[model samples]
Target: MNLDTLKQLDLDDREISIYMTLFRLGPASIRDIAGQTGVNRGTTYEILKRLAARGIVSYFPKGKRRVFRAEDPERLLQLAEEKQNALKHTIEQLKTDIIPGLHHLKPDFSSGNVSFYEGDDGIELVLKDILATVAHQPEKSYSVFSSKSLRQHLYRPFPNYTTQRIRQKISVKVIALGEGGEDAEYSERKWIRTQGQPDASYIAIYPPKVAMISLASENYPVATVIDSVEIATAQKVIFDTLWQLL
Candidate 1:
């Protein structure tokens, strides 16, 4: 049996070793299991107690010594089912209790928030945050200042972002700074005449937050997220003004 899978159930290396040793030796005392597994007797006894609590091992009296053995392998399936149920309950509790409580703790405009991120992975996180925020809002439309260079950098890491956004029924209005992006199911795009392909920077204006991503330097992609209703409102006004001329 591949013992690596047992690690997913929170078993440590010593626990796995002792359990496998008992499975092989059948109803053996702690001293025999410890000897076979090369672990000290005290630690082996502790692991046996934990496995018994997990219902994967059991013990019986063999004279003055206690004999430990692995329970039926089928017991592993039962344990997995229990873990699944526990995870499901946890998700429900978060949705009903935890998330709402956290939202209530959000800071107002008197105290604005600023966050910085670096590299491709950080950019992807910003994009996902945009999607998640839009998903929960009453008005799901956002405006964007898009650039060809920035799109190329992000598409490699998040190829399915547009698809996911469309699936969520989120909509975007974009002013493509240079050229080479197309309108998708839930998006509208207008192009601005530029001398050449514009430098790689992206600005997204979603109410209460504005995200700026710079991918102009291939080796040093970075992003900044600002949470302020005032800043977002100003950016939205500017985008709308430029959007009308194009």
Candidate 2:
């Protein structure tokens, strides 16, 4: 009998052992359950009471003695459902109460807040954040400084990022620092002439945030996101200035 499921329902070792013993033995006396599970009679009796309270174990009078039995195995599903419902209610409470309360404790900073992420998954997170942040903006658009060297690695983590952006009706303006980039729906691209290999950095300017993605090592990516209205607006101004020149 797999007891892992029972363990998740908050059953301790002794309680689970006694419960399983009753389940297998069928209508056993307290003394018999204690012996089978190697728990003392006093502890065994308490565990049975706890399980009975949970509606998983019950007792009936067998002559002068009470015999305990496990409820149908299907009752475990009911326990899981109860846990799920309780979690749902807790999540609602957190959103309305706990989260806002915790936010109040956070330090208020005007600017220079930065977060870092590493590897392909991290790059994907940066890309997703860009889309999500831009999608909610009044104009639903953002600006990018794209480099040819980092462009291939940038989308490896999220190859369908463009598709998702177009689906959301979010547009992007790209100032390409090197050779190649594709034009797509809801996007505008401009190229810059450069000597030697272009710098391997991609910068995105979305209001209230700017995300920069680059290589920490060959084929290994890292991203840093800056959260500040002043910095993002400055970057946006610079990008637009360069955009007009090109």
Candidate 3:
């Protein structure tokens, strides 16, 4: 019906255009089909050949010209069923192989690496990372929150990370800039605040592992996390010194 509909079957733009044109135009030669679809003759022919091999199209010779016709639309349903069965078989095979295979798989996280994500997706990543660390070790987890620029999405939906942290009995230490604390009503009962300097940014301290240094840019968030135990303790020390002054 539409390019989007065809794409669900994994047909790209050209394939979809050609196939849909054939469906609308009835039996026609490759050249006519291409003209009707606004696709080149060669590409239309190739797509039709692929479609024919899938048994959703058929071709027959009529005089000197070849005509192509779409199979009944019910074939689309059958194709989807075939895919479902194949995925089930593959998943069953994966169950047999995944355990031993996983033992051999090693994820390489560079000592400190940089990853870039845009918009709300980026914020979600930061939220997940922070919450997991908090739940893992609540008492030792601390956050120094500042909102240099994070007003637009301050109240947006974050994936139930806070609830998870609370359920795990993670103790959170929140240190906010003076106005930063006033801006949002954070549920973390253990919190500290300071006023002034709205552009100073936010810092998160998680014990034994990661510390996230996030800047609250109004449009997006930018943060660098240091996960080395050595680095995390050094950060905790800095936070302690700051906490004492507050």
Off by over 4 Å in 1: 109-112, 138-141, 166-169, 216-219, 237-245
Candidate 3 segments exceeding 4 Å error: 63-65, 80-186, 193-199, 204-211, 214-221, 227-246
Report the lDDT tens digits of candidate 1 across residue range 36-155: 999999988988999999999999998999999899989888988889999999999999999889877976644348899888788889889999988889989899998887777765
Clashing pairs in 3: 138-171, 177-194, 178-194, 178-195
- lDDT, candidate 2, 76-182, per-residue tens: 78999999999999999998999999767756553337899999899999999999888868999999998999988899989999999999999899998978999
Model 3 global lDDT (CA atoms, 0 to 1): 0.66
The lowest-lDDT stretch of 10 consecutive residues in candidate 1 is 103-112
Candidate 1, position 25, lDDT:
94
RMSD of each: 2.8, 4.7, 6.5
Rate residue 54 of model 1 by lDDT. Answer: 91
Per-residue accuracy of model 3 over 9-120 as CA lDDT, tens digit each: 7778887777778778898899899888888888788899999998888999999988999889899888888888999989887767875586447343454344444456
User: How well does each candidate superpose onto the true structure, as a TM-score?
Assistant: 0.84, 0.66, 0.57
